[model samples]
Target: MSDRVELELGDLQGGILSAYGKRGFPFGRFLLFHVNHPAAGRRFLEGLRPLVTAALRWPEDVPKPAATLNLAFTFWGLVALEVPTRTLRSMPEAFIDGMAARAAILGDDVGRNLMHHWDPVWQVAPGRPRVHILVMLNAAADREGRPVPELEQLTRLVLALAGQSEGGVVLMEGHAGADPRFQELAALFAENPDGTRTPLPTEHFGFVDAIGDPVFDGQYPGRQEWAKCIGQGAVDGQGNWRPLRTGEFILGWPDEGQEVATMGLPLDFSRNGTFFAYRKLHQDVAAWDTWVAARAAELARLWALPSLEAATATLKAKMAGRWEDGTPLVRAPDWESWQAARDRLATASRAERLAFLTAFTFADDPDGRCCPKTAHTRRANPRDMLDPWYRDPDPRARRGSILNDRRRILRRGLPYGHRDDPSGEHGIVLLAYCADLSRQFEFVQQQWMGYGLDFDAGNDMCPIVGAHGPDAKFVIPAPREGQPPFIATRLPHFVSTRGGDYFFQPSMTALRMIAQGMVDPT
Candidate 1:
């Protein structure tokens, strides 16, 4: 709202803005398509703009209105659309080449290390296009564990609309589920023998998942504080640090770079749009459990703990930088402290809640004493940890890096697979949105997550999620000085890249441009 940061929510796609906010819609489906008939696809793409949600339409309330269903239209599918080839070339090369190419470019440390390297569905032939467009349908789920009938109706409505464009055909469809192997873990985290479920969200990993997500402006009025903590807020040493510049996530506006994004060949076609990387990540629950279970007992004996289970929980928190319950280690530091924070949060003031979760920086604890430098959260954001260092070496510049601005990505998507199917095909469907894949998403995946020089932990991948191989180890500093560090070694691949593709989520305006055959580069 300030004169300096004018974000046009109305101009941006709602899905690109706040579509996944407010704990996200309970039930959703992913539809993948390959453009078969370009003309038809154009019509389809154009028709979709009218149906797409706008950021301005986000409900002001906690829970969205009943029967509320939203759609985000993005493309790998666009390549298959009837647009001219030159237009495709004009787009980001990563978007044109897709995630497989991007992954290959990211090298062995990141992409090749992915479990999906062996996935049958993920064996995408080099240069052979896979998924083209990603149609995300998010709807509220009923207590009966059924997709709301209204959502089904909404699906039919969208399908009918898609019928208007012959630009593409269905390539595949993916839904959220947990493998059968996930049952025990799900029960441990969230389940009852009565066979019923609670609304309390828990990922297949059985940890309180999906915490401390960055909230952009236009999504919520109170997210300014949340944004700043993530490197989006104030760059200057004055004023309230707000959420990252809107352009950092959404295209068209100024980004954390303080520059307007030059999207694709035709600027208008790319404006208000963002790029999304769709990843079907398969979680190896059994492997992750085996590793942790072995360590938890050793830790219990070392700490003289009464229960191995509690020790396991602590190790998990240390691995993820948060307890399975979503309490952050940076704030809680230990089980007792984590619980205290959790209890307080039940009635904590707004300031208390924000500070409890969003507040905290690595500046003071640069040593990874409290929250290990190699923790998943630290790798993903780095907070003030990566403050720009090179230009002037001024204390502030050395602490915060504008490069962090270019690296921040907006995460979306939900878990796929059934909860009780242990060894079942349960995993998370991740949507990483950013203006540039190589700079933002790929950089984080490679530099920060896979390689640890950024954390001063040299060559150490993320202990929990990174591509850890045999003899791999995660060092959790001892709680008190002089105490030895707890090392969890021989970590198995907990999550594998099952299947993925990159697509462009264009602005509604761009969708219309594509549909109307108006994508002239000149």
Candidate 2:
């Protein structure tokens, strides 16, 4: 019998299963709306339902759609839609409180990341309307990264619906620093002289992004499923790879805990649904470039590196736990190895390249010699580093990676604004989806990224996204004998929160119930 878990594709939202930017739809626009009248809100949803894309597998015979749309509702949105009181109270407290309310716990209340410093749309001033609904539209981009005509048409339609005087839904403004209307997102790309664009996975910081996203059952099809899950999914003590339980990401399914958690009353209302943490994170490229340059100069002298360029590259790789091109440090522990790996990848097949990038273990580097324990990628996903019995002589007594399976989150979203503008409105619209917000998303953010206890790094936060100040530092351990560890000091905040919120992305069934006013919970 096959152990594969079949997902309810038609019932799930497309955004949950697929990262549209990686699937050829790279340009995106996010619009926030405030629902004033429940009746009008339902009417708007009913009209918009047809445009919402489902998580159905695309047929190989047909061309992919030029644009895709998805929807998510805040807790306030459910209230605005007049959902039953019982259902409202049954929601997870973290979602009920929302991202802004939990800012301190998330380490977002300090410095530029404070809620007051966020975009005007996220600032809930006295008598101002709260963001209720979020409509995400993704469209295909041209070779030059410009949006296709279809995106404008779809935008017009959505604007028309929100602009109707009696529609009772008002569009929220001041989200994008460049436009002050809707947040525009686009993946960074390289243009070819032949009028074709090659999407570069790198973010504004010039490092490749989204390299090690979690893989779970039913995420891929057939043989590709297990193949893709290698090193990206749960691992056993015997060093075997397998997909994580579907419930880790989808609702009403068994998770890594081997049981389904309590859902909102009336199973259908919450089945196949999941929670999302929408975050607008602004990257300070100027600060990042300046800091890395100065640090690299000092590192060149300390480490006796060849040149400033090599020192800068090594410095970035040390902090990121991978080379800028997405090669894991475990696979290429030094500059020479990184260069060799790059050469191999230059002629490797796509599948072969992926394995080189992700198929590696941190068990050997327990002391973090190859990759710093506090490196951004290492902190975010420790892999086997968190295993309690990893150091045990008896391999059978070890717990490989059970501890991290529950904390994995599906990352989706794309970079926004121009990459050339160092001080301009530029950042990533980070979207994280998981069955439980506190367990998966919040835990990773608070414990892994914000704190340093798990990695034995003593309050030293992740250098990439962690809140930093003059006292902040990241230690890079030297593997060779007689070489002292290099400490990069006086770290600056590389990334900061601009605006964000918690949202519940419902299944198609739940959406229908909401639109039809059949969400009864007695």
Per-model TM-score, in order, reads 0.85, 0.97
Q: Rate the local accuracy (lDDT) of all candidates.
A: 0.64, 0.88
Candidate topping lDDT: 2
Error of 2 at 262 (Å): 3.4
Q: Cα lDDT of model 2 overall?
A: 0.88
* Candidate 2, poorest ten consecutive residues by summed lDDT: 56-65
RMSD of 1: 4.7
lDDT of 1: 0.64
Top model number, TM-score: 2
Candidate 2 regions off by >4 Å? 60-63, 165-167
What TM-score would candidate 1 get against the native? 0.85
